[model samples]
Target: MNRTLTERARSMRIHSGLPKQFWAEAVNTTSYLINRGPSVPLKHRIPEEVWIGKEVNLSWLKVFGCIAYVHIRVFKYKNGSNSVLVVKKDDYDKCNTEKPIMKMDDGDSVFKFDRSGPFFFISGNKDNSQKDQKLIVVVLAIRNHNKFPPVAVPPAPVGQTPASSPSPTKSSPSPAPATTPSPISHTTSATSLSPI
Candidate 1:
């Protein structure tokens, strides 16, 4: 997410011809700093110049890059501090611990999900028998929208339909050829017709 955001910021600055200090100030939120690249200026440098307007909006702000505590309902035995995993992807699924619909962690939450792909994570699975921590490593595929769309396919070439389909029946005939008379003959015919 930070990488993508940084790339976007770079492009935004380039297109706008704005200085890096402007972006640095606008994206100076503590959370934003944590998630963004090291090249971005420090929080002190971020100022009003980078903001869309005179002031930045904090109401819509969220924790930058954070280690989210995954809720494990299936296997509750395994638990540790180092269990923190960098979120590789986020899909708004009700089943995943970080599902938008589901509850949120008390503290900061950094969910990393590809802009266009399912979310997945690999960790130790919680074991039923063992006393050690058993973490579940699996990929939770969730649909962003409620509807499940069918796979799309490109159309075939023109004049050719499906294999089971029949060919075209008939088409209109070509137009007849036009006849152009010589200039001399046309003038002579006109002159003779007028006189006689």
Candidate 2:
């Protein structure tokens, strides 16, 4: 067992970018995997199963140092989507919504989950109609696109600049006043409105 654990640790170290400081974690993880992982000499039954005389759950098996994506049970896993809307389990089931839900942990003011995956949440979700909604906290993972969003950048104006950029021999002209587009309002149209 000691030899196997060191061997696994050595393999992980070769493949992982983890530094020597995390060797302890690697060894511990390797030991855990060895005790739970299947062995050939034991006829494919893991050490834990052989000791306990029962099949053990291997669902938690993971690489010592690797990236993993978390599967959210209630969330929509649609095309190239990068966000999850966390809702209550009951509400999600009741509504038969495709939105994601999380299991509420017991006996704690806060619960933390080890993160994986590629979708991040935008700030702020509030419902004026729901009183207890403020207590809901959500964590989201965002897929990293190598590109960064432009800072403090807005849409360019529809037309060319009012003044041409200054030349060495010419004086620069002041920029023209910018026009702000009016917000479009949606009201009941004559055709859509119906008598109560």
Question: Among these predicted structures, which one has the highest lDDT?
Answer: 2
Can you write out model 1's per-residue Cα lDDT over 1-196, one digit (the tens) per residue?
5665555545443334433443543234433644432334645534443543344444655432222344333222234422222233432111233322322232333443433222343232223113332222332222133233554577989999767765666987669899876433423342332111
Q: RMSDs, each prediction?
A: 24.9, 23.3
Per-candidate clashes, comma-separated:
12, 7
Clashing pairs in 2: 74-100, 75-100, 118-143, 119-141, 119-142, 120-141, 120-142
Q: Which stretches of model 2 miss by more than 4 angstroms? A: 68-108, 111-196
Q: What digit string (tens of lDDT, one per residue) describes model 2 on residues 52-81?
A: 899898887755556545444332333332
lDDT computed for candidate 2? 0.49
Worst 10 residues of 1 by lDDT: 121-130
